[model samples]
Target: MTLIDEGTAYGRQRQSHDAEIAEVGAGTPGGEFMRRYWHPIALSAKVDATPQNVRILGEDLVLFRDRKGRPGLLYPRCAHRGTTLFYGRVEDEGIRCCYHGWLFDVKGNCLDQPCEPENGRHKDKVRQPWYPVEELYGLVWAYMGPPNKKPVLTRWDTLESVKPGQKIVATGSSQGAGGDDTVEIVPTNWLNDWENIMDPFHVPILHTTFSGVQFVPEMGVMPEVTWETASHGMRYIAYRKLEDGRELDRITQALFPHTRIVPDIRLIEGPAAGVGWVVPVDDTHFRLFHARKVPEDFKPIEVRHYEGRKWSELTDAEKQMRPGDWEAQVGQGPISLHSEDHLVSSDQGVASLRRLLREQIRTVAQGGDPLGVTFDPARAVVKVQAGNYYRKK
Candidate 1:
């Protein structure tokens, strides 16, 4: 892709991801559009021993765990002489730049500049190139939004789906489900995939037609799905429970700005019932991370190839493979063109998501509250009858 000239707006010239606006990212409005929330960078496990370099929102970063079991996110370079911090050593406090011994804490606070003044130091006066990071739901998240207004971390029922005891006592239980060690990344753009998490209407079509059947027989009965904003992104509460119509299906929720509570976890050798997270690498590229805890008898398997450079980097071949999402979004162009979109009633989920997104994005700009503002831990087995495949009349 050719670099857009300064002040030159760039986006899909054709029917893209319903997007045409340039100035959305970085110097453009597109980059600024993405700089509104906290983005996840790595699985918590990635922050051990050696530092891991990461790129998010077009910025380079370094990740590592401290000796005290604290994970840190820092600028890729040392403030001193601009040394790359990815080669830094993990210490009990934070990551220490291997060169000149400049130490920085997880928050990027310069702790020790050994080459500088001795006695207790003036390191606290300086800050290294870094951002605030938090470990939640088995991943390391960093806020690339504004220097302030970082939203509170929202929780999801899936994290508590399994009993704590089940985690410790279950024999040979795959810890990925209930534990905090498993996090996988699928490269793509945030909008293309994040929209999928909210729109369940695609499964019976895309997965069944293009890919293959991945849903249960009960899924054949697509029920009418109703959506509402909650402590999370949007809740697609199904009006129909199942094919049998007896048991009430629990609500499917997407935690804003990313992550979802899937009814199925792809635990078995086949795709199990599962939840997924769409993490932003930048406006153009992102990742899907799914941590599953399958049945003791189930074994999940799949293969993914990493051919792209970081989140902000994409080769033409990598661009073509944009994964399934690429075909869904970019094929439409840089942004999906809404003007050319002929949405049918089947696009209900997509309609709802877009409506809510437009609303929330406006709210965010006006300094108003976004969805999933303050979570209520009221767990209920609500009967959700979403649009499932029902036998036609």
Candidate 2:
């Protein structure tokens, strides 16, 4: 018997796992866990006299470079009157609050307090909130964790393996401007984006099965994968059988916290790209920062843009017909409900990654250093093992 009318009610019940994993504020478990490592905040070329608004780890910050060429990341609100430093002036010494001419250096040391005369005895007592920032490989990275726990910012081998005539190119959307073929702020949790790197099965299905062919032809064939734990993170070694009676071995890596080393989408004729970071803008947003070394004379590589139109410009039917990772990932509804997902054999990597992240979180909770953190500069250079290999028939 069919009922005359029926309706379904949606509940907002959330799980403890989701709350622990998704929330990334200062006091939150995920935030404290992630802050133990350095994360990309802005591209080096983009930081200048103008103060840009940045949000990371659920905190609002202002990023700028002083006249003397020192980059800074500080709490946007002025310490004196809670005025946003976004309108502050960038001086040779540091940034000066426009409200009352209070000056602060990159390290948040109070340099001068104009309103408080007599050498401003109270100036030394007041310090604005700030984070430690450093630049490497054309990106500005910040460590938002405890000062004493700051780790040496690592320089991965891929970024330094460039040939004599080749240089690294910084291409990504930052502060509302950059190369046209770069990704902007993704409207989903950072984990959702990071998890995709582990799920190799989706490549043959999402990029090839539903859509005609968005990636390399070799990727159209499904792969048999094996996951292994690296010193810093995890790696997925995938093998694909090709029509030429040769096998393809693609090794992809996900460095602890956020960085992911992905292969060329359309197959690389030259050297593979350097590691790129999946920086968390906040709990609900994230951005991508990628650097690839290319010949000095090389121009920007053009990627397929859905008939030359951006993803946002595509129609609903168009997106449905040519669904990409953006659709598949963001479709997980911001922070995917981890408790609701059913783990299977194919989800081994995802499960492993989650366990590793939880272990790191637990380590931090136990007052121990997480993986890959070091204070010694000499030991900061990491060699990443990720590339594509083709076997001879």
Candidate 3:
């Protein structure tokens, strides 16, 4: 056969990223799907008492509280003089842009303008692009979707189970994982890291054995997992119980279009962490915002940025002594090459996840309701099989 024909015969099928549905971050089909719901925009600590500059889903936004203690989400630029709100002055009413002194509230209504006389009477005439925001589990969430479609603030049992005295802390990583208080930006596509939430199989290798043994042996046995569609562009997966009975059963939860309750393999008794994402920075890059709720006596989660070894970069010796997150998922490339992959029984969870995602895209295209679309009034407990797993090598 000719080279072109031969290549085609041996080539693999492209994934959603290869098509319009495939986007690395903002501006892709996947990103469009993700914007249909509320996404975590910043860690609560990042926006306290001061106007903070934030970016999510490729949109730059500001998270600030008005004088009435109401949180506001707005595009970073002020309508008055196109000033960056990061330098804006926080007031009892809202943030006042520094350039033209245009003041706005959480609802984006321009309240005052120093440049305009008449005590800023014409302020109401101008509107700043602001979205609705809510604080949950100490994180700020924003809805970038149509205002009519904005859903209510929500929490699963895993989050509700957390009390003030419990271990609830915000993630420092851009997408929230590494033990830092700073955000990290990837040079690749956003989907590359977002989809890592669904592929549970990678943990055992990339995170556990990839470095050395990040997870306990009992945590490594792969379990039966399945995925289903949720509202907007979200996907949910459930990992059933493992064969061993003594090991306490646990489920790690991931919400689409982007969010996750990062499993803590270090948990000796209860859960280890929780993480969620903000919007993508672009198709080739994205940022994350996360929080971890560790057990009451988990030794303060000593891991920080680079004081400890990262999963991504480690010498065999260094890796042997370190746990990893680097290789965990992002290594699938800035965006994964779905064609280069080979799935097996162990990967059923990821496979099921992709199928459900495609299914929902199809549903939305046909103007049908996707799962998790309606408001879950009761705020039920969301369970998914997540955590450590292994396949016989």
Candidate 4:
């Protein structure tokens, strides 16, 4: 018998994903768990008179603002003739479909049917499907869960207290930071980016060592790290010794569901001022929405350069050499196959995150509320503890 080389891929079987934690379509285990809380669907400025088409959780919906200045999220199809409401005209009362003149309010109520007698005597009986929308922190949030299970839209304490010169700013950009040249929607599984927030080990290796100090010189220092389970989600503290005999203690949190609370990577010496949401457009595509407090004319996302070239200016070969988060996460494929991952002791944070997500999925499946979601108005505001601190040895 001929002996074959060990561990060759010639006859290896295909890998499988952890579907319970990856799939995010309606009725899926992960989808149901994600629906338990509100998600930022669009920037407030983008939803105006003209309807904007959006896809979230594998469902296509239209978002618009009625002439009354109320934001609405509705099923794009007209209930009467099945025509898309994308071409509908915005009127003071509601949106009027161009096909049959059917009108719908922000709550999906049928206001009128102009093509029928007495504006359609049975108009009150017809309704269009819609999700509840609320504007907060310069972003439009939607609750796509069961009506009875809807909770208050969460407010972050870090984004609330704006000083005299500072105001709440929001972005729906690539990685929640990149400029116009970057793709607004990330082409990868949501879990790929979501789990990354917990894996602090990557910063020293990927951002500093491999990427050649893409962030800051201090980040190049290997940190002493510890992880813990926080009330909302998981938290990690990384301590790095500086050349001046001072230690930098950075605290970051991965809030329940898909929120990331990270201190300003510029090593800003204060509490974190922003939060980012990794929202799933589907099982394979995701987008980021971030809100932070900054002074007027301040651009929150700093343009990054590698090898003396901006990210957008790099060639394919250059990208391969100096890949950032976009390349790293998306390279894991649309949905990473969990069975193929060789996790180790350094991956404790990633493992813990997956376990927590599975627990939440099971919780929702058992008809119980998931963690970090509260219906009480008093508990709607969540305090952020992620920040940068300094200590002298």
Candidate 5:
């Protein structure tokens, strides 16, 4: 067990992952916990007359808007012959299966069966699978849990208090961070990115020092950090003293389920203007949906640059030279094996996030409601406490 033989890569073994907190399928603990809250499935602008295939929580679904202007999400298979509805046509009533010309409404109610007698004498007996969907904050939210357990779609105070001429702009690309260009679907487990929200120490190291000032010079200063558990999830505050004699308190939050409310990287004052959701496409892939308040005709500023080139403009070699979150998270492979992680004092936030998630998973396993979910409309709006504040020392 000397240095020559101990802890060597020659015979090192890979450890198993924490599947209970990572797997997001129909019946898994993590999936069931996620189902307790509504998640953004698509940008409202993306769901149009053309049927688009989407996968969420490990289920394949088709999303489209009917001629009546109602958005619908349904199982892709035709109820009769199992043909994918992706080839189906959108109609005034709903969508029509190309196979037998059977028509179903947005709610998956069979409306007509052209080949059957009397428009299908038993058409009423067949129903296509569908999920409950609603449009809010420029995104389509869906509830995939038990119908009786569906809670009111929670709203955010930050997004609701839009001033005149300001609107909530929703982006579903590039990890949904409001970036104009970047990878859409992240090829990794959702938890990898979700956990990163709590680990603020990486900002100064990875984005600043390692990536050569990706955000701003102020972000490069290492800060003293503290973590706290909120009713919804958990939050952290990073304290830094600026050269100009102002104490900076940057607060970031990871809300229950999968929402991250982070202050602007430039240390903008006031509460966080947007929220991002790490949505699981399946066990190995995920996507991000973000909604933020901005002025009319607002354009995204390219702040993260490496060697005088924007992230989207960088070549593969440049990306490696100036790695950012995408490189760090995706580099962890499809799923970061939790068993291999060696926790440190600085990883308190990451540790707390995992603990919170585990508690919710256990709550669902015991047939109880998870955190941050409510049936009361009066309590549906979540008040965000994340922001950047400055005080004179």
Candidate 6:
């Protein structure tokens, strides 16, 4: 064969992969799968008298709290003449369309039509599309799936099972100090962030080794890991041999439909006390929603920002010098091409998570509940095991 430069070859094409896991629009596998559960749409404090534009699963919608403080998430367009509800008025009973005074309540029920005849059958038949929204943990969560199949919002055991003197700290935004109410919106696919939770190998390499001691000194050493399926999702156990005659065992939980109960960001050597979520904004963007509990005697751990600067405040050179998870995940492009990935043995957890997500999607397509989802509130208290423990050799 003649020597050839592949770089000069014609028709070099990039293969597509995992559209079922990446795409979150209506009717797509991932979209259909995600709609089956409750997702945090916006922070509860963010919604007010003025309607705020919110998008999830590729659907354009508006979230607003009326004069009476009742929260409503409705399709942005008014049922009458398709006017955008963003320009509507929030009334005592519901939101009224500015176009013709069509009023809709939290349940999407059309309550009034000022411009229509008193007996106009159109007013009775007209209803704006809306989703069920609940205010929990300082976040506004919405169920965008079938009305009959909607499952109860979970109060995870990690938050509910707190012992005496332990209380929950609800962080409204994904991007603030430990107790701040602001959050930063990350620019990447939801899957990119979710998959990272299961990837333990990267901890020693990315955060510790190459990144130059971003975490505790003990985490710099490489770890041997094993993964297994959990009732609500999956868990991975990592063993790191310490310099002394002891082994550090870290267990992280990857909950189904985008939740992670991992170690506290503070690097504490105990059970994970935080609930983190990767909430999809669309196919190409997502945001993080987190809540955790702090012991009475312990100080709360702050969310990680790079070198005391917000991600937007970081210089390109600074990011290159100390790249974090955001840089690593977003660098893969909006939606990563799994076909192009050369996954190895160390990628076992990631591979397993992808398979489990695909299986859950398939289950939902077959008209069944995905793993860890329950309609009963009593049974919704999920038990998760994820913490760091030390054992003497």
Residue 81's C-alpha lDDT in candidate 1?
83
Q: Rank the candidates by lDDT, best first.
A: 5, 4, 2, 6, 3, 1
Estimate the TM-score for candidate 5: 0.96
Per-residue lDDT value at 71 in model 2: 98
Worst 10 residues of 5 by lDDT: 174-183
> After TM-score superposition, what is the CA distance of residue 97 in candidate 6 from its true location, in Å?
1.6
lDDT of 3: 0.60
Find the 10 residues in a row with the least total lDDT in model 4: 174-183
Clashes of each: 49, 0, 25, 0, 0, 2
lDDT of 4 by residue, 1-393 (tens): 999789987879999999999999999999999999999999999899998899999999988999999999999999997988899998887788989899999999999988899999999999999999999999999999999999988998988788888888898887442223366888889999989988888888878876678778888788888889998889889999988788989999998899998898888888899999999999999999989989877865546666566677877787777777877888899999999999998888899999998999999999999999899999988999899988764
lDDT of each candidate versus the true structure: 0.56, 0.81, 0.60, 0.88, 0.89, 0.81
Model 6 misses residue 342 by how many Å? 0.6
Clashing pairs in 5: none
lDDT string, candidate 2, 211-283, tens digits? 5676667888889999999998899988888887887788888878877887766655323566778788888
**Which regions in candidate 1 have their CA more than 4 angstroms from the true location?**
1-38, 117-122, 168-187, 217-231, 237-251, 265-274, 291-339, 374-393
Better of 2 and 5 by TM-score: 5
Tens digit of lDDT per residue, candidate 3, span 102-193?
Answer: 88888888878776678587777889898888887677778776566555555555555676567776554642433232336665566556
The CA-based lDDT of model 5 is what? 0.89
lDDT of 6 by residue, 1-393 (tens): 998776864786767868988889989988989999999877777789899898787898999999999999999978878989999999899898898888899889988887767734576677788999998777889999989989999877777777899776665454521112343566678888888888988888887765566667777778889999988779899888888767878899888899977785445677888888888888887878877787777774443445776555667897787777777887888888888898899998899999999999999999889987799888978775898877654
